[model samples]
Target: MEIKTKKFKRDLLNWYKNNKRDYSWRETNDPWKILLLETISQQTQLDRADTYFKLFIKEFPNPETMASSSLKKVLILWSGLGYNNRAKRLYESSKILCETGFDELYPNFEVLPGVGPYTNNAILSFAYHKKVITRDVNVDRVFSRYFGVDEVKTFIHNNKKTLLDRVSSRDLNQAIMDFGSMVCKSKNPLCSSCVLENNCKKYIVKIKRPQEAFSGSNRELRGDLLKLLLSNNKLSLKKIEKALAVDREKLLKATTTLEKDGLITIKKNNLVEINS
Candidate 1:
């Protein structure tokens, strides 16, 4: 069944008008805030992201503020967020934004650290109000099911012009994401209450995969090492192993990975510290 683009869009927009999620970031057109929110949301749940967003905004309200701040300070604020590299990249990107400014960086946002295709489009659509789709996994799932197409990218490539016509890109993207999360969930979708139920060409039911255990994982070990380092200035390799209660080999591997990620550094005499 062919998607009735006009009716589908109208129905989706109408649903969004009433069902859209309220977020503090949604109230502003500030690109910096949107970029920060988007970057933080990449690895965090929305509720937690909101909390961190508030913290970050309060600490570094603008690119200039973040640019001038130390990476150590940013990482300290980003302690519980887990993905320390994002904070690093965000810090680097802020420096560039401060040096060049967003107006000069407009449409070429990918030049900023960690700003990929999805993020670039997100900043454009949400901040600049450009008519471009932010094709994240949620949007992909919604469109793939609605159009009954396995290859969503191909479909979007063929129909992107029609998709963007006469629609607010920001609202449409947000609505689809919300609808995907709330109604067309990956597991246990609420098909009965879906606004596009009749028009949806396929109803894909995905099995919910069990989350991998974080305990005893390398990720946990890395977090432990970083947390310890965050509290103190530095620790020796032997101390880290003893503190983490892991063997020397495992500690070395974790430290090596952390160093490679630019999260920490191991100096002479095997002293480990958060990368400055």
Candidate 2:
């Protein structure tokens, strides 16, 4: 069955108007703030990222502030967020943006430290209100399932421009994001409650969540080690191993990875500290 684009757009926008979440980042049109939120959100869960986003904005409210702050300071605040490298890249991006104007930034958005395809489109539509598609995982899922089309981009590429004046790209993109997150979730979607259920052909496919166990995983050990280091200036290797209660070889491997990632440093005394 062919998707009724007009009806879909109407239902999506109407549903979004009634059901959209009040995320703090969504309340404003500040490009820097939106960029910060999206970068943090890439590596952090939305719920936890919400608290961090508020704290982050309060600390570094704008590009100038973020650009001035040290990478160590940014990482300190970004401690539990995981993927600490993203924090570094975001800091670097801010510095670059502060030096270059926003007008100049968009043209080079793709090459920016953290601004990839989805982010570039996000900035274009959300910040500049350009009529472009922001096809992230959520938007992709919503469109794919509703239209029963595996490649949602093809449809958007062909039809998005024609529908732009009728349905603003920002509204359309934001609606799909919310719809996917709330109703057409990755696991056990609320198909009955979804706005598009009546018209949707239900191209639902089960996705497998990663089975990486945290007990002895490198990520777990690294997190444990960082938490220990965050408390004191440094911890001896023995102390970290004892505190984490992880295998010697696994702990060693995790520490090596963290060291290479620049998250930590080994001192002459064999004490590990947060990298300066």
Whole-model Cα lDDT of every candidate shown, in order: 0.86, 0.80
Q: Can you write out model 1's per-residue Cα lDDT over 1-276, one digit (the tens) per residue?
A: 224776778899999999989999986789999899999998577889999999999999999998888998998998888878799999999999878988898999999999999989988998899998889877888888888887888887788777888888988888888888888887677888888899887746445477667888788888888889988869998888888799988888888999998888899989998877
TM-score (all chains, Cα) for each model: 0.94, 0.89
Candidate 2 weakest ten by summed lDDT: 159-168
Q: Per-residue lDDT for 56-132 in model 2, tens only?
A: 99999988898887777887898888776788788888888888867887744877786898888888888888889
Q: Model 1: clashing residue pairs? A: none
Sliding window of 10 residues with minimal summed lDDT for model 1? 203-212
* Candidate 1 structure lDDT: 0.86
Clashes by residue pair, model 2: none
Error of 1 at 199 (Å): 1.4
